[model samples]
Target chain A: MADSPIVGYADALFSVAEAEGNLSAVEDELFGFAQTFQANEELRSTLADASVPVARRLQLIEDLLDGKASATTASLISMVVSAGRANDLPAIVDAFVDRSAGSRNKAVATVRSAIDLTGEQRQRLTEAIKTSTGKEVEVKVVIDPSVLGGAITEIGDDIIDGSVRRRLNQLRESFR
Target chain B: MVASLVSLMSIVAFAGPASASGESVGSCVAEKFEESLHHHGESDHVTSDDIHHVAHDEAVQDELEACLEAPSPILPELTEIIWGGAAFLILLVIMVKKGFPAVKGAMDARSEKIRADLDAAEQAKTDAQTVQSDYEAQLADAKTESARIIEEARVTADQLRTDLSAQAEASIAEMREKAAADVEAQKAQAIADLRAEVSGIALGAAERVVQSSLDADAQARLIDAYIDEVTGSNG
Candidate 1:
């Protein structure tokens, strides 16, 4: 967790979703929404611009995800955005996923790529993360185009960087 | 002179007959003889005796006339003139004895008093000259002292003004520098604040773009590729 308050918010949202019997859908929706917010610059700008009041930001979230997500999931995100935590949404969601995985003695495998992963690939990647780290893992995929191409993975303290963006940055630094 | 001629005329007019003393005696004697003749007539009535008596009287009168007619027989008196001359000589001797010495002594005292007065006037003139000279010396010194004081005051005033001007210029320069520095500091601070605000906006916008690209479908695809790579590597 990045901060205690952020962790506290994550725990609180997790308990609410669990109690509603919609924990799986809530977590999945929240994780996917957080990734979308992190990836789209214009969308993030609209959501986080102080000129757009918090009320407006909340309304925007409702218009997009009101019926698409569970009431608890939508409400939790609306609460976070309305309470002025749009900038911290990705951190809060990541913390929640980590907490969820930790409940089952599993590590979180955060993956970034330009395209969505298939179910077989997710299964294989999870087993591979378990085999490499010698621990059980729950894979969470985040789509990012700034990855440009290829993929980057974060498992606990380890980072596997295979993204085209990293290669380009290395090339730039070398020229300098 | 006329009073003396009148007295001479009056003396000639009142003078007696030249045979007055004898005539007067002879007359008285004839008067006595006549008385006797009258007594004799009464006794004898005698006429020839009376005629003889008258003849004798005429002879005695002629003798008396001869004596009175002499002019050089009498002289004037001299005893009263001698007594007046002796009284005038005694008065002249009293004047010479006392009056001359007293007049001479008075003239000498008056001359000595005039000489002392002239000497006192000369001493007074000298004292006046010395007092005038001392006053002139003091007045000259005062004039010189006043001139020196005025000169010194003028110099001091000029220097004071010069020093004051320099101090004012220095103070003005210092204040100007301080004001310029303050303006520069304020300008730098405003730029720093704008930079921070701009950087925040840029970072937020970048984050939003990255998030927008990482949709669920894209995230799933990236997960699939990462899984293939990881498993393939292990295999």
Candidate 2:
């Protein structure tokens, strides 16, 4: 399994959560962390930089998930960082989320927002999407300020675009 | 002369049948003609006595009457007719057997030659007609062959024109296609360069504007409010 590092790491994290009876919490926390890691390229580069000591990278991951996530989630993330797989964190988190959703028979909806959504907003948006699509969805929101004012949602091949970025592109095209 | 006249008169008055009359008749006409000549010789002189004159008048009167209405001096007899008829028949027979046959043969030969000449003329006319018809047919064939050759030349010229036109059209089409492809490639290159430049400027400006407009707290509150509105409306 380790021959394919992306899948191997995802599987190991998935097993740890399942064994600890906290699969859902681990999936949510990993999804948030992967989003943050992608958003801040400086932080991601520093953590994934090979010049930094392996122990320092592990300590950084522990400090990141100290109070925000469950013990199993923290341990699994720390283990991936310790294994020197920080560069593959986003891909590994996606693999893990896909595996978790498939097991639960729910669809993955990746949402790009200007900031993190509140718990109440998350619940309502999920229920609203379920009602509209007639399928249970695990919504993963990423803070992307480039989207300007509105959120953009992608579910498989479908895109629900409500972003100022798209508007601006349309305006640029008209100018051309 | 008087005595001879009396004698000739007596013979003429009493001539016999052809048994002896041919000689007598011949001698009688000759003797009478001679005796009459002798009387004219004697009576040609004017009379000296009245009785002589009267006698001469009577003789002249008698001669005149004899000359006017006297009988034939020599009568035609049977023996003479038979001999004449026989001679005529002999002459006719000679003409019929020899002269007539020769003339008829010459006429037949002439007629046959004429007929042969007419046949030769007819053959000459037929041959002339055949020669004329053959000449006419040959002339007509020459005309038809000339016309066909001209038509073939025209057709070949037209086909050559068509082939040249088609080739020109194909060349023009190829040139137009190449020109269109070049234009399309240039347009695509321009579009790609413009897109790269525009996207970089737009992303930078947009990132700054959005970041300045909303902090994490404001973004979260706005998102929660939007979500709340959407859920409440649906319910």
Candidate 3:
């Protein structure tokens, strides 16, 4: 697998999951790996550097995941890095997520927040989104410090922004 | 003295006639002759024969004297006048022939020389003017050539400067374009990273929603509804 072989690997992974009857679990794990890769700049740079040995990069992935991920998920990540596809980790994960969502008949809704939401808040927000858009959503949230307060969500091409960052930007623009 | 002797001879001839008529012929002859002699002595020796001779010589002597002393009828004074006039006429002819021709020739030669000198001067002046004009023309040509060369140099310098400025501007524009491309690539990489991070959070959030919001039966029903929605929309 090449450095930018995201789609190819994603297709292979999706097929493998379909064959093994564990698409959801693999998709979820891949999604979490993508998040960890994005948030950690040092990990991304290390994995992407061609000078680092393939064995060392694979070991780094194993050590990082340890007991947090399934055997299948760890093996899959290791295989990708060993093949020098570390830079494509996020794209592969996104593809896997999309594939899994498609198989289960659902839309991927990416959401961001300054803090983790309670159970009631998630339920009400999901119901509200479902009622407003008339579509089944698989909601995912990212805790971002840059959000400051409030939440912003995206479903496919649609966006729902209700955040302190956006309010402050508007205020700054008005002052200018 | 000649005239007194002639007068004495005339008296004796007269006295001889008187005495001859009065005496015998012989005695008369002797006495008359003696008397003539005495009278001649008294008259400065005048002889009777000398008186006859005087009377006979008178006409011939007068004729001879006339021939000797008539003042030379062909006048030498007239000959001298004629000779002097002829000499003066010859001198005048010689002077006219020699002096006048020489003077005329000298004047003619002088006038010819003057005319030739003037002609030579005119020719020299014309040659000098020609030479001066030629020099002036060459000078003008040189000035024009210098001006042309200066103009060409100025044009060449301006072209070089323009070319240099254009090259510099082109280089700056190329550098700016490369910088912009690099920036765009970096921006794209950053956005992709942000998107991936947010997707992970969304996954975790979804899991939490599943775990907290619904029991087994509700989950099954929610799953069924999602499946129905997706299939209906896609179909």
Task: Indicate which candidate wins on TM-score.
Answer: 2
Candidate number achieving the greatest lDDT relative to the actual structure: 2
Q: Candidate 1 — which residues are off by over 4 angstroms?
A: A45-55, A169-176, B1-229, B232-235
- DockQ of every model listed? 0.15, 0.17, 0.04
Candidate ordering by lDDT (highest first): 2, 1, 3
Question: Per-residue lDDT for A1-176 in model 1, tens only?
Answer: 38998998889888887789877788899998998888788878888788888787878888888678877888999888777787888989988888887877887888887666678777787887766667788878787667766678898788988775775556544433
Flag clash pairs in model 3: A140-B202, A141-B201, A141-B202
Judge candidate 1 at residue B94 and give its lDDT. Answer: 41
Task: Report the lDDT tens digits of candidate 3 across residue range A1-176.
Answer: 23336777888888887787777777777787888899999999999888998888888988988998877888888888878888888878877776678777878777676556556556656666777777777766677656555567778778777665675556544433
The count of residue-pair clashes in candidate 1 stands at 26
TM-score of chain B of 2: 0.48
- Residue A90 local lDDT, model 1: 92
Per-residue lDDT over B128-183 for candidate 1, one digit per residue giving the tens place of the 0 to 100 score: 88888888888898988999999999999999999999999999999999999999
Residues B1-235 of candidate 2 have per-residue lDDT tens digits of 3334544554454444334634444455455444554565566453345334444565654654444453455856566566556545655666677768888999999998999998999899999999999999999999999999999999999999999999999999999999999999989888977886787687667666766877667676666655655455436
What does the lDDT read for residue B136 in candidate 2? 95
Candidate 2's TM-score reads 0.47
Docking verdict class for candidate 2: incorrect
Report every candidate's CA lDDT.
Answer: 0.72, 0.75, 0.70
